[model samples]
Target: MPDYDLNRLGSRAFEQMVVALGRPELGPGVQVFGDGPDGGREATYDGTINWSAAAVGVPGGSEVWVGHTVLQSKFQIKPKPQPQDNAVWLQGEISKEIGHWIKAAKAGRPRGTEA
Candidate 1:
């Protein structure tokens, strides 16, 4: 695909993949968070992590980052977060932080303001 399309698809793909990883049908113990400032995504599996493939940069080297991790962000070094990075993390502390922005969003109308 073209570089523009690939860049636009990065954050979306990461969010979807993370949600897929957290699917109860697929299995449990998986959690994810997206909507980052740079349009990044974070995911964890089981409890093991490698932190390598966090930012699967654009295919053509246009300097577009793909993913972000709890410990580091691909934007720091612009290193290629290839498909091989085993992204995983722990909860407890991060859960609170994630919860800060994890609330369900609605396009319009407040929960109690309806008339």
Candidate 2:
């Protein structure tokens, strides 16, 4: 497979690409969200996730995930991006998302909703 130049795409476009790539494996039930605050979710899946049958070259795909699953997409615009350059920022962003989810859980808000 060829490496995709994700930097060419805007954030929402990147999210769309992610969703398109995942929908097959995640199933048709995946819910896609739009711009603004997504409550840290770009996409949400509530059912069993499996490798698409075509993905695994099998009649029926194998199970991968179950229950609520949240997807977040981050696009790095810097040319020739390196993971090390964004490591700290990525860690912080991930922590922020996790914190948001924890706070939401404590507040009894649903998994996919904003506070």
Candidate 3:
């Protein structure tokens, strides 16, 4: 696995992930579904393209989700992460670094890494 300075990882990578998401052609049918009242956004597509998420910059947010686009998905939360996203590759490896941007109640910078 590639090495990324999680300490410096912020919302930059996540932002790029969202933008790359616009290019569904990057992978197969994509979907961004969320539970609860924050009905956010979802995307999907069906194309034969390879892709990979290079651990760079910040995935943004406090949550980091990892998995394939059409086969599987997963995420882990630490102290918390800024709602962020990952990069899109053209290879066969399918993974994600999604960050859930939920407003905190304390209104201050959060800390730690997430799953």
Candidate 4:
């Protein structure tokens, strides 16, 4: 579980990821929607080239959500390659995308800071 609300955080993360990847048009492909009382919401990211992501909100003080990205079934037929299995690589990519958002949120700052 993540420290922030998964649905919200994940959606933001996915959006940032797209932008960081230099695909501004793809950012909007990540959608956030209500999921009722059982949870906060769901993030629907467009599945393209076997890539997709989702986030779920859960109750907790330290963490409120869990986010995950998956290679679509069609692309996962073979075992995960070594490069794909590297935790650092995945973490770096995700962090590069979401880390700024998380930092801004924690600092009570807005996006697009000049400082």
Candidate 5:
């Protein structure tokens, strides 16, 4: 298993989620802390767009967290239509990520054994 830092992993995962969303306008706002000689304690990637199609984060960990918030054209309590055509883009993104995950899993399997 690959050991990854929580904040770094979260940021990367958030960025990947945005790319996976396929909406150029929906890219996340990423910020990093601790760039100086002394390393800082935290970092974050704030995503402005809501990912109704997918969620990111580990399955079972207290430190693991996932959140999504959709922005409406107006501040209304009722649901509203998203301006971008997200259906097709979301499908393609899911397919691509699933394929990559499958490939990685296969590659990680023991040599000469069924994947």
Candidate 6:
């Protein structure tokens, strides 16, 4: 086995990789949308996902995630030295996307549903 340079993979490739790697956990029915406008999501699953609380960094046994699940991929290879050097910016971007989802839900139109 050999290790490859993951940094060379652009955001699209990284998103694809994330989908592939998550299949086992997210089930085989996970839908992946490559390219074009993502609408704040790269992939989605509308079913049960069996996982352990430890997998989610919590202390517990098994856990189940049911209903609609959205997956987003964010990878930055710019600024050289450390792409994650701007952790605050990355977190802010994620928070904004989450806020959009929450707002839509509050308005009775959850994401992935027709308005």
After superposition, candidate 2 runs with Cα above 4 Å error: 1-3, 51-64, 79-82, 111-115
Pull out the clashing pairs in model 1: 53-85, 55-67, 55-81, 56-81
Segments of candidate 6 deviating more than 4 angstroms:
1-4, 53-60, 79-84, 112-115
- Candidate 1, residues 52-99, lDDT tens digits: the string is 344356454333323322321221122236533322222333454454
Q: What residue pairs are clashing in model 4?
A: none
Which candidate, 1 or 5, has the higher TM-score?
5
Q: Candidate 6, residues 1-115: lDDT per residue as tens digits?
A: 9999776898778888988887777878888887876677888899988777346665576787889888887776673465466686688878988888888788888664534
Q: Predictions ranked by lDDT, top down?
A: 6, 2, 4, 5, 1, 3
Per-residue lDDT of 94 in model 3: 31
Instruction: Residues 22-71, candidate 5: write the lDDT tens digits.
Output: 43444545333332321111233445544443444634322322443222
How high a TM-score does candidate 5 get?
0.25
Model 4 TM-score, 2 decimals: 0.25
TM-score of 2: 0.75
Looking at model 3, residue 114 earns an lDDT score of: 21
Error of 6 at 55 (Å): 4.3
| Backbone clash count, each prediction separately | 4, 0, 30, 0, 0, 0
State the lDDT of candidate 2 residue by residue for 7-114, as single tens digits: 778777888999898787777898988987677778888987665554575546554656888878776566335667688777777888788778888989975576
Q: Which stretches of candidate 1 lie over 4 Å from their true place?
A: 1-10, 18-26, 37-41, 47-115
- Candidate 5 off by > 4 Å: 1-84, 109-115
lDDT of 4 by residue, 1-115 (tens): 6586323435445444433453332345555443232111233344442222322342332322234322111112222457557555656656654666567668887433526
> What is the alpha-carbon lDDT of model 5 when measured against the actual structure?
0.40
Q: Which stretches of candidate 4 lie over 4 Å from their true place?
A: 1-81, 85-87
